[model samples]
Target chain A: MIEVREDWCKGCNLCIERCPIDALEESDVLNRRGIRPPRLKKENECNYCRLCELICPDLAITVISDDPDEEEKKPVKKTLLTPVGGKIK
Target chain B: MVEIKTADELNKKFLREGMWPTIFCNGCGHGVVLEYTFWALEELGLDMDKVIFASGIGCSSRLPGYINADGLHTTHGRAIAFATGIKAADPDFHIIVFTGDGDCAGIGGNHFIHAARRNIDMTVIMINNFIYGMTGGQLAPTAPLGSVATTAPYGNIEHPFDICDLACALGANYVARWGVSHPYQPIKSIKEGLQKKGFSLLEFLAPCPTAYGRRNKLGDIKKHWAWYDDNTILIEDYEKIMTYGSEEEKEQVKDKIQLGVFQDIQKPGFFESYEKLVDRLKEKEAKTKEGKK
Candidate 1:
C-alpha cells in the first residue's frame, strides 16, 4: 500500500521529479479538497520499489513492505530481499 | 575519557542477529554508524519497544533495518518530518532519524529547517560521507568543494554545509558532530540527543569507504578510521584548533566541529505546541456546533 499525506505535501514534485520508474505521475486534475495537490496516478503499478519513498521531501509516503505483509510485520525475521535492499532471500 | 570497550564484546552482547545490515558495502560508514548506534542504545539501556528508527534515503537510510524497532523508512529527505509525527503521537518513544547529507540538506532541506524550528522531540543522525553514496555517488550539498564524485569527476565547485552550524542556526535544541572513528563521542552525543527533550541533530562526518574510497585513496574502512584519528577534534579543544595558519594544517581544528554535545537548551517541544493546536480546534468545533443549535 502506498500511503501519502497529501496535505503535508508541498507539491515540490521532488517525489514526482525524482521517481526513477515513472510510476508516479502528476494528477491531471486537482484534488477535490485542495489547490494544486499532487496525486499518485498508478497506485497498482507501484513496484513497492521504495523509489517514491526515497524521493518524497515531506516524508509523506509509507510503502508497505513486501514478503512481510502488514500481518507478518511483528518483529520477526520471517525472510529477506524480495523488495528492500537485503539479499538474504 | 570514557572507557572504550572491545568491539567483539560489544557486538556479541549488544547487537541482535539481524543488526549487521547487508545494505551497506563492506567498508561503508553506515555499518560503522550502526555499530556505534547499537552500542549507544545498549549502554543507555533504551527500551526497544519505546525506540523507533526513522530515515530518509541514501546509504545511511539503511539504518532502520539494522536496529530492531518500530522502524519508518520515510521518503527521501523527510526522515525528520516523519519522525515528528511519530514523536508527536507518543512523546515517550525515542525517535531517531538517520539520513545522508544529500537527503537531509539537499532534497529534504525545508523539512529539516521546519522540524528544527518546531523543536520536535527527535534525533537526526546525519552521516556526512562527503559524497552521496547512494544513487551512484553524486556530489551532495555537504560535499566538500573540490571533492571528486560521480557528478564532479573533475572536482566539485560546491562548498559543503558545515552541518553543526546549520543545525545551530536553525534553532535546534541540540547540535553536535563527530567523526565515525572518534571512538566514543558519536555514542555519547547520541545518548545526549536521545535524552534531550527537543530537536537534536547529531551530524557525523562518517568516512564513506565506497563513495570516497576510489577517489581519495582511502581504500578501506580501517584506513578511513585511521584518518579520522588524525582529523577529529573534540569540542572541548575548539579554541585551540583555530590557530592553524594554512589549509595544510593538521586536523588540529577538529575541536571546532567534533564529538560532544554542542547545545542542550531546554525549550518547548513540538508535542507541547501541537496539543495546544489540537485543543483549539476541538474547542472551535464545539463552539460552532453550539452556535448552530
Candidate 2:
C-alpha cells in the first residue's frame, strides 16, 4: 500500500511524473496547504519500485508491503560510485 | 525483497523535530539537496555537536535553521567570512556553509573566491536556483543567459557564472556540481567533500519553480526537471567530446552545464599552515631568549 502525508505534500507532481506504472495521479481535493496532492490511482498495480519515495523532495510518500516475510531480509548496503576525476576506493 | 522503511522513520533520524513542513515551495529542489546532505552526514557518522552550519541570507541559507545542529545565520553574503573566523578559532569544528547563487556568486563573490584560494577546512554548498527567490525573483549571478527575472524583465543580457569552474580556477581542493535529479551522486559528492581536508564547494542545481520556472515558461515541476535533464551534460561525457570531437561539436556542447567534480586534490588547509607559522614563531622567540640569557 502507498500512503501520502497530506500536510507534507506540495503538489510537486514529481511522484506522478516518475511513477513507472502510472499508479499515481493528482487528486481534486486540496490539502490544508491548498495544494492538490497526488493520490494512488492503481494500488494493486504498484511494483514497489520506491522511485517516488526516492525522487520526492518532501518525505510525503511512503510505500509499505503486505508481506511480513519481507521485513526479515537484511537491508543491502549500497556502495557509492567514485566521482569523476577522483580515485575509486 | 528489500525492506521498506516509511518516510517518517527515515526522515526522523536526521531531521529536527517540530520543524515539520519546511518553508520550501512545491517542487523546490532545495529539499532534495537537504535530504541528500542529511544522508551524507549519517553515512559519515558525524557528531552533530562537532559540526557548525553557517549560512548567508537567501532561500538556501534557511537550511541551517531546519537542521538540529549549531548554526550561524550570518549577515547577507558573509557566511564564508563568518565560517573562516569560526574555523580559525576552533579548528576542530567541522564548518559547513550553505549559500545561494545570489548570496555566494553575487554579493559575496570576493569571499567565495578568497575562501577557496585560502583552502580553508570547510564545506560550502551553494544551491543555484538561477534567480534570487527570496528577494522576489531578482536575476542572480548564476542565472542563465536570456532568462527572465524581475530585474531583467527584457531578458538578461549578461552571461552567467559557472561556479564549479570558478572554484576550480581559484584552486579549491574539491569542487562538484550536481542537478537535483541525481540523488545518489550528490550524496556521495557531499560525503567526499566532508572527508576532504581543504576547501570543498558542492554546487547543487535546485529548481525554484515559483521564482525561476514560472517566469521562464518551464511549466510545472516535471518540466523544470526535464529542463535539467535535457540541458545538462555530464563532465565525463563532456571530457570525451572535448578529446575526440571537432571545434563545431565542442561549440555545440558549450551551452550544456557541466556536472561532477571539477577539481579534487590533496592540499594543506589554511589552519594547518597557520599552526605551522605559530610554531615557527614560538621557536624563534625561544631561541632569541636563550641568546639573550
Candidate 3:
C-alpha cells in the first residue's frame, strides 16, 4: 500500500503516466491547493515498484508495505512516517 | 552498501529546512533535476561548505537557494561569468552553475560559449524548458521551431539551439543532454559531470507546464512526458544512424533530441595551463638571474 499526501500533491499526473500497471487514477476531488491528486485504483495490482515515488516532483507519495522482508531492503534511517492527519508509526 | 533511501529521506538530508514548497509550478521538471543533483552530490560525498553554487536570473536559478550552500544569485544571464571568477580565484572550490536556456543561451550566449571554450573546471546545469517560464512564457533560444509560447501565440518560426552540440564543438570536457522522463540517466550524467575536471555541460529538457505547455496545448504533464519519451533519441543510436544510415534516414531522425555524452576528452583545463605558463616564466627568470651573476 501507498499513501498520497493530499496537501503536497499538485496534480501533475506524472505518477499516472509512469505507472506500469494501471493501478493509479486521478481523484475527482481537489486537494487544498485545488489540484486533483491521484489515488490507487487497483490496490492489489500494486507491486510497489515505486516509479510513482521516484517521479513525483513534490515528494507527495510514499509507498508503505507491512511486509518485514521488504522493509529490510530499505535503508535504516529516520523517515517521515505520517501523512496529513495520520499518526506517526 | 550505501543504503538506498526514499526520496523523502534524501530531501530531509539535503533540502533547506524552512524552504518547504518550491516556487516551481506543479509538474515542472526543475525540482526533479534539483533532486537528482542533490542525490549526485550526496553519492559523491561532497562537502556542501566547500561547494559554491551560482545561478543567473530564471526559474532554474532559484535552485541554489534551496540547496543550503554558499550561493551567488547573480544578475540576469551572468552566472557563468561570476562563477568563472570564483573558480579562477579559488581553484579548489567546487563550482556548480544553474542556468536556464534564456539566461545561458539567449542573454548570456557569449559567456556560455567562452566558458566552454576556456574549458574551466566547473559543472554547468542548463535547464532548457523551451520558454522564458519565469518571465511569462516568452520565446526562448531553446524553444523548438513552431512551438507556441506567450510571445509566439501563432507558433514560433525561429529555430532552436542544440546546446549539447554547441558545447561539444566548443571543447567542453564533458557534455550531455537528458529529458526529465529518464531519471536514472540524468542522475548518472550529473554525477559524471561533477566528476569531470574541465567544463561540463548537462542540459536537462524540463517541462514548463504553466507557461509553455498550456499555450502549446500540452498542458497535461503526462502528455508532455510522453512527448519527450517519443521524441528523444539515444546518443549511441544517433551516432549509428549518422554513421551507417543513408541521407534519407539521417534526415528522418534529425528532429529527435540526441541524448547522451556528446564529448568527454582529457584535456588540460584553463587553470592547469595557466599554472604551467607561470612555472615556465619562473624557470626562465631563474635562468636569466644565473646568467647575470
lDDT of each model, Cα atoms only?
Answer: 0.67, 0.85, 0.83
Off by over 4 Å in 1: A1-89, B1-21, B241-259, B276-293
Native contacts recovered, in order, as a fraction for each? Answer: 0.00, 0.46, 0.29
Per-structure clash totals for the candidates: 1, 0, 0
Kindly report which residue pairs in candidate 1 clash with one another. Answer: B233-B254
| Per-residue lDDT over B102-193 for candidate 2, one digit per residue giving the tens place of the 0 to 100 score | 99999999999999999999999999999999989999989988999999999999988988899888889999998887678888999999
Lowest-lDDT window of 10 residues in candidate 1 chain B? B248-257
Worst lDDT 10-window in candidate 2 chain A: A80-89
Deviation (Å) of B257 in candidate 3:
1.7
Query: On residues B90-126, what C-alpha lDDT tens digit does candidate 1 reach at each position?
Result: 7889888988889998989999888888888888888
Per-residue lDDT over B201-271 for candidate 3, one digit per residue giving the tens place of the 0 to 100 score: 99998888889888888848767766676677787877888899888878867777777778989888999
DockQ of 3: 0.18
The chain B TM-scores of all candidates, as shown, are 0.82, 0.95, 0.94
Candidate with more favorable, higher lDDT: 1 or 2: 2
TM-score of each: 0.65, 0.88, 0.87
Clashes by residue pair, model 3: none
Q: DockQ for each of the predicted structures, in order?
A: 0.01, 0.31, 0.18
